[model samples]
Target: MTETTENKDLVQEENVVTEETVEEQAELTVEEQYEAQIAELQAKLDDEENRHLRLRADFDNLRRRQQLDREAAEKYRAQSLLTDLLPVLDNFERALQVETTSEETASIVKGIEMVYRSLIEATEREGLQVIQAEGQPFDPNVHQAVMQEQDSEKEAGTVVRELQKGYLLKDRVLRPSMVSVNE
Candidate 1:
């Protein structure tokens, strides 16, 4: 190619397009072109920022939902085990309601004792424990006074007998101990 002044000017013209050519390409004036490009870039940046915010929000929602589901699962996991134990409690109630045959009464009583011991032990394993009330000072937080009696043997306001053993489940009380207090 010859190094001509006209050729160089043509190259320069191609590099730096005229205002009329630019207006024709985008169908806008020079000022409008600058404004449109800026607006377009701003819109794209806004869309990208909004998309990132939406994704972060989705992830946070998923984490919260998962935590709630885990809590629900833990709450119901012991339901079946507790249901199975209902029949044993029923049997105990029945045994207390009526006397047994003389022939089998001793064995039945022994069986009941064994069953009660094992049930209590099992409950302890599951975080259940009996509250101490006999011969101790009366405390309303853990002990429920069923009857008050005058006794010379025990100090006044001391528990003489336990009517029904109270139980604790974990750190919370499942039942308050029923007791007779010497007044």
Candidate 2:
């Protein structure tokens, strides 16, 4: 009877130890699951933050590009009107070249000259400038070589004569001067 009682006590102690070990394993598993979930949530949050930063940078670049475009448009606002009036200005120049024989013709010529001067003044105020080509070095940017000539008096690559005038609006070339270059 003493042996039987000792055996029963030992079995009870073993059962308690097994239960405690199983409970400890269960708690450990639950903690591991929570840690994994926290890691996953942290990764997702970091990804979202990166995406937001990229979107903000792109938006800022777009806004800057649009502002530059607006400023350029404003700067060249009168370009089209000035371009359209260039042919009329050419006609006025041609009309002024006519030789007047009589007093009546001279008066008409003087009136045309006054009108031409006014037109030139108005165009100048709007940033129109005549490009000087004659006796200067030939430049493809502001002068177009319509014909090349061999001249003993001028240096090679110099502009011998300007056939038609060129105009500029601010720093932009409206038309290149038609010129003869010495070669």
Candidate 3:
């Protein structure tokens, strides 16, 4: 072949090789881009799933807390009414302590005592309890120190007497005992 023709053929061959290299590079770049896009989408999906799981967990915790609060409220529903009735119970106990000589009066007192016992039973069934303060060690949490007395028989900081009774509703203190503490 002529020199010009040979040069043209060489140029054509180089162009063909360059085109094939460019096409191959383009295909590889396209595949790499597709993989990158897939990775980005997978990360976004995982993030959304984690957020949903967290939200669901938070909702479940909130529901459980609300249920516990509701149960607690129900358990203590009678506390206020029982607390208000304490004074009446005290009066009943005081009346029973009075002495009467006549048979008729004694019979009436017995009836009152029966009623007082029934009332006490009902209160006890509902978790109302009397705090035992007389002759016990003085505790600031359940006893209110109204007076202090120096007593030879009792130890210091002991409860000498309970002036007024204290009460508990379940585990919670409704009232603290009014007491005289030995000092």
* lDDT (Cα, tens digit) per residue for candidate 3, span 1-47: 69999999999999999999999999999999999999999999999
lDDT of 3 at 75: 83
Q: Tens digits of per-residue lDDT for model 1 on 1-183? A: 566988998978886787558757767566687998999999999999999999999999999999999976675555456446645755775675566678578687778878877875776676666689999999999999989999998899999998877765555565678999998
Q: Considering summed lDDT, which 10 consecutive residues are worst modelled in model 3?
A: 71-80
User: Which structure among the candidates has the greatest TM-score?
Assistant: 3
Model 2, span 69-115: residue lDDT tens: 99888877888998898888999999999999999999999999999
Query: 2 or 3, which is superior by TM-score?
Result: 3
Q: Report lDDT per candidate.
A: 0.78, 0.94, 0.94
- Pick the lDDT winner: 3
In model 3, residue pairs whose N, Cα or C atoms come closer than 3 Å (at least 3 residues apart or on different chains), thus clashing, are: none
- By lDDT, the candidates rank as 3, 2, 1
Q: Cα lDDT for residue 165, model 1? A: 71
Measured by TM-score, how close is model 2 to the native structure?
0.85
Question: Where does model 3 exceed 4 Å of error?
Answer: 1-3
